[model samples]
Target chain A: MNERSLSTTTRATVPIHRRATLWDRLLEPVLGVNACFIYVFLYMPIVVLIAFSFSASPFSAVWGGFSIDWYIQLFQDSEIARALRNTLIVASFSMLFATIIGTMTALALSKFQFRGRNAFETTLNLPIVIPDIVQGISLLMFLVLVVHLALGLPTIIIAHTVFNISYVAVIVRARLHGFDRRLEEAAMDLGATEWQTFWKITFPLIWPGILSGALLAFTLSLDEFVVTFFVTGPGATTLPIQVYSMVKRGVTPEINALATLMLVASILLVTLSILLQRRRSS
Target chain B: MEKQRERGQLALLLLPSTLWLGLFFLAPLGIILVISLVQRGGPVAWQLDGSAYVRLLDPLHLKIFLRSLTLAVLTTFVCLLVGYPLAYYIAQRPPRLRHLLHFFVLLPLWANSLVLTYAWMVLLRPEGFFDSLLHALGFAEPISLLYTPTAVVIGLVYWYLPFMVYPLYGSIEKFDFTLIEAAHDLGATRFQAFRKVLLPLTMPGVMAGSLLVFISALGTFVVPALLGGDKTLMWGNLIQQRFLSTPQDWPLGAALSLAMMLFMSVGIWFYFRVNRESA
Candidate 1:
């Protein structure tokens, strides 16, 4: 564990590996260049997409003078508007239901004793671990063939909530681990009811966790495509579904605009989620 | 009486999650199982028919399965190789820089994967970004990578690279850098130190990251659909087409889906076993 005392690479560079051969000297710079290359590889495509979204050209990679023509076209398309609205509806509703159920489950698992702990954990993980395509097809079969139910907004919402619950539960469970159980017991001991203790102590403490979970669920539901595509009926097109068809049909600058907006929204929300998680841990 | 009340409250708290998962999650999986066992043609759907599972044994279907497995394996291997140095670089940074670098590594994961794949579509398509760039540089036209297996592999690699980096960073950060110094004190060369101590110490991370990337790549639907086109049909695409396209072969799709679930369960089980042994 004494080696653990040196946490950074500065020691290796300055004093520790000073016996470094020429090859050793070269290794650090090589690693630095490789890191730069990987970051470029990751961001280059998205940068191109965002750049061309503002270009006047429909599908050309060449800069045909920067313009917001595609953004205007995106706004004017009624189909895109409807799809955005549907996506919001699915995300909002799923986030709500998933948050409540997942928060309750988190409390139950962490604050109370339970049997079948392994079984419960495995069941929750099943929705997350299984491939989306498989889960999508399974739900499609259940709704269409088994129950003869129609596929539409409700089906999409149900599928999203199923997966979202597990995500929300996991995040809240982590937050719970850092919390003191005695706070709640103390509140109850001071003549408060169980419900009162929860409202005053537990809820406020875990509210950040719940908010993070809700944000995550909303973000995930917004981009969900495979399950929504499989289980969806005609007329309920979400943003991702719209983008899928538009891209498959042919090149339109409208898709570039749409993709850019979704990317911005996702990046912002995800950053916030990560920040919240960091705050919780710290 | 107090104990009974506490138990009642626990049950109440868990009820909503249990009820929802049972109805929407487990029941649907059970439905898939039921669908896989039944016949496609008959009005009497209750009779058990092994035809769909048998159909998977066909050489054509087997070919697709094998190709998908190979592509997924390739993607995992390539991501591991490409992502390791960056992971190591990030692990070596000081605290603040380390945090910032981690954000960069995780940003791709938290962002929209669909748009990311579409970004690749823009670059890889015929007469698209790369072709135009090449022309601008006075080169020949048509990289012609679109609608090919290589394009599929590239897209998969781009999408799952962060998954590879994440687990690698976790394990590598905890590794003692002094091990390398100690090996050097014992007169091991730099390469020898890396080979003997560093790689072996980080084997758990390598395996974890590989499992994550492999499982995700195998089941990916979007990359293959958008980039693979008609030529490179993966299990995900095959299942999608069977259910969504004409002829509506639900039974075959269900069987294929179950098979995929089996593959994934095995991968995860192996992953947990490895972690346990290391712990």
Candidate 2:
């Protein structure tokens, strides 16, 4: 009877064990392979470009030998230097405007109950959902018609700020969501004026949020292409526009070097932002 | 008195952003809508007409829209298939390593898109890296991969895959593995367990990622312009050529832009509806 029960129990569990093992054997390798293949696919082209940037030859596709001549050449290119200056100007000014406006918006949304709050929220999020092309076209048309704003640095900065404000607001508002309000209340209760309390208590706490938001806005505006493409006038070409034009005329080794440097800069900024955010949260 | 002061304070805080958005974003969109109904005379002139809207119903524009839609849908599908597994693997990683993996996934976005596309050009051009590798592997001939629809799709997927992966990772990171264990305990097979439990649980990520990828893919002009040679002009290129190229058909471009916006709203509505039901 014991033997019979053991055999029945074995029969009951055997198929399930077989199925589980079979599924794992089939799927585990497939999943691993898929994951590895995707990683390679994602990084290979980038790696190829970075490696070829140092080639002694002018042709990017064919590597000759190791040399930094392209890097030196990139520094001497007057047009690229001008684009870089334009890019920095737009990114910094736009970042400043976006941060101030966005922080205030975030503060208002978080601290108060108001009429049309939902409408305001939706308006802020609209740019995120709307296609970039639509945004670019509409903004271009508006600048050209209603404002008669000349396509130049100012227009580009304004366009960048328009979308970037929402990004900044969202990030700061996320910080405000978990904020401790009692400290501000305590400062108010202890005879601190509203403005003074804000300067002393609240601002210091959300300072990280504002800084990170500024960084994000800077990064976005620096690399913004589509809208800038629409609004940019002669002598106002940003790095991306310059890069686009260069790519159109067949990439030179100088561009490859420039691209590699830009990639490294972007990675460094993003990593710094991540570290700042992590430090704040921790 | 306190409430009044609070209201004033809030208004003071909100005014600048509101004014900026109103003057720039909302007003521009309104102007575009009006421009769509007007006839283009030249770069700076317009006549009140609706020829652009009428032209959209023509077979040619409709075909372009359908083609863009098809490409977007395909790109989204491929991204989902590739991104879901990658995100799942990343989410399964130890917590300390997950952040690094996520950063790696997003590294491409930090790099300029034009440069990224140029990299692909280097890899896929005639006698390029991909061709050379294949040739070295005993392949007799190089593949004509550049300036093709397949090349365009590959570039789009590479450009936007991180957007998909990030959202999926967000949703999947919060996934409850206990339910899978429960299914296993209930004698369901692994396939049945995943289909019944894991898939349903991660549907939100799938929808979110798909929506993000689809809209962006549909609106992209650069990928197609760079990778999709002259023959494979999508809707975005059509809109671009209208405004920037010969003829400068601003009205038609506005109409096309509005159509895309309308389509996006519909997609977003459907997404929210699905999201609410799932919630």
Candidate 3:
């Protein structure tokens, strides 16, 4: 009787174990499907954009046939070229200015302790949280009324630098957070002047952060729209503004081509930065 | 002598950025605040009138503010739902594979948001690729995905998911697996282990990510403008229209901008407070 009861209990528990295994089996594939679906959802639009960039249809919806005509036209269009050039000029200037200012601020904040430090840090990051539209309009109004700065490349550069500096400061600050101060002290003890020590020791140590921050700032300046939209005068139309106007008019095949190029360039830059960051961390 | 020189060097290093912020950011924002206090029309037009604050209290503007808040809240909730699982899965992966997964997470962020909006516009259009694909898959009707609030949500969620994911990933990666094992070993079920152990540990990351996504989504203009179409109206578009379009009401625009800034400042203040307490 006892053996019979034991067998019955084993039979009951074996099915429960089997059911648990089955549950695991079921969930594993479900999880895989979920991941795949999310990734596809994220990437499918980009894939379609690239695919239709080559489509012969003037409109994106009807894929008449495959052709690179839009791309060829993009090259031939002087306006697009001019916008691209202006964007590069603006981004380059913004990147340069933001990098220098950002690095300097990061160095100061990391090395020094003073009253109002928290307030300063928060204030620097304030631009990040402010809506771009508000920043743009306010800056536009201010440029027109208060500062009387020309609403052209200079204004755009200044506005870009304002936002870009925060990004640079944040990234460089992250790198600076765990930096070994002893190295700087060692250099100083070895009789290096502050400027020479910074150039030889601190600058080189923080070079990657500066580079990454500069790259990030460059990318931001390249892609910045709303602020540029408000600040840009008639003579200075960047690629994003051009794209916005194009989008407003209607979707066109040429825009798909231009967008694909922009997407590719940005991806390359970001990938390079990520790779560099990983290398440094490793 | 060296200490003085170091202080001088630090001052020199700090001067440029400080000046940039003082001139561009702080000064302009101050100007906006001053303008927000002024009347719409008068002989001394720019003089402080306090009427713009009253204008800000108008129901239409209030409605727009509420709509922005609703959208941002919804976006943050959805991002959390979607991002948490993916972050967990990535965190569970081996270190080598984790980096690859993170690269994909970062990929969307690298692409220009405008281009992403355009991509969605293409896919979500009436006869767009997505509609065609759905029809080919045996659906009788093409879904009306474009120019809807749903599209706005999708764009917002898509744009901000990375912001949510990265922070969660940061936290999850640092989570103590041993605690989970201990919970399980104490006869707790798998779900119980996750709830009692893992969730609490990752809460900080969740909070940070959600706040970042919420603040950004609240202010987003391009996504809504491009994807929301005629049906959906958010404050960003409203503010843009007032400033740039036919109305050209600088006072109203300035008032709206000030109100938005005030809202953001309050939100950020709360966010920092919570973060500080948690830390």
Candidate models: Cα lDDT each: 0.87, 0.85, 0.83
lDDT of candidate 2 over B1-279, digit per residue (tens): 999999899999999999999999999999989988887777535678988899777898888898889889999999999899888777766565677888888888877787788888878887777777777688888797999888989999999999899889988877766566667778877779879988999999999999989988998988888888787788888888888898888888889999988888888899999999989
* DockQ (0 to 1) for model 3: 0.43
Which tens-of-lDDT digit does each residue in A1-282 have in candidate 3? 243343333223223332355644565576566667778878988988998998876444546798999999999999999999999999999999999999889989999986788998888998887889988988887898887777888889999999999999988888888788998899989999778888998778778888989998999899999899899998899999999999999988899999999999988887777665545632
Q: What's model 2's overall lDDT?
A: 0.85
Q: Which should have the higher DockQ, number 1 or number 2?
A: 1
TM-score quality measure for candidate 3: 0.91
Which residue pairs of candidate 1 clash?
none
C-alpha positional error of residue B231 in candidate 2 after TM-score superposition, expressed in Å: 2.1
Worst 10 residues of 3 chain A by lDDT: A10-19
Better structure of 2 and 3 per TM-score: 2
Please provide, for model 2 over A1-282, each residue's C-alpha lDDT reduced to its tens digit, 9 standing for 90 to 100. Answer: 243343333223324444557766666577778888988999988898888888785443456789999999899999999999999999999999999999999999999988899999999988777777778888988988888888999999999999999999998998888889998999999999989998998888888888888888898888788888888998999998998898889757888898888877777777676666655643
Calculate each model's fnat, 2 decimals: 0.68, 0.57, 0.53
Badly placed stretches (over 4 Å) of model 2 are: A1-19, A58-62, B43-46, B136-140
- Tens digits of per-residue lDDT for model 3, B1-279: 977876787779888988999889888888777777776653127666777667767898888788889999999999898788888777766566777887798799889999999999888887777777777677778788788888999999989999999999999887767675566557666677778888988988998898889988988899989999856889888888877786566677778887777776787788779878867
lDDT of 3 at B117: 91
Alpha-carbon error at A3 in model 2, in Å? 42
Task: Give me the displacement of residue B143 in model 3, in angstroms.
Answer: 3.1
Candidate 2 lDDT score at position B250: 87
Root-mean-square deviation of every model: 2.1, 5.3, 6.2
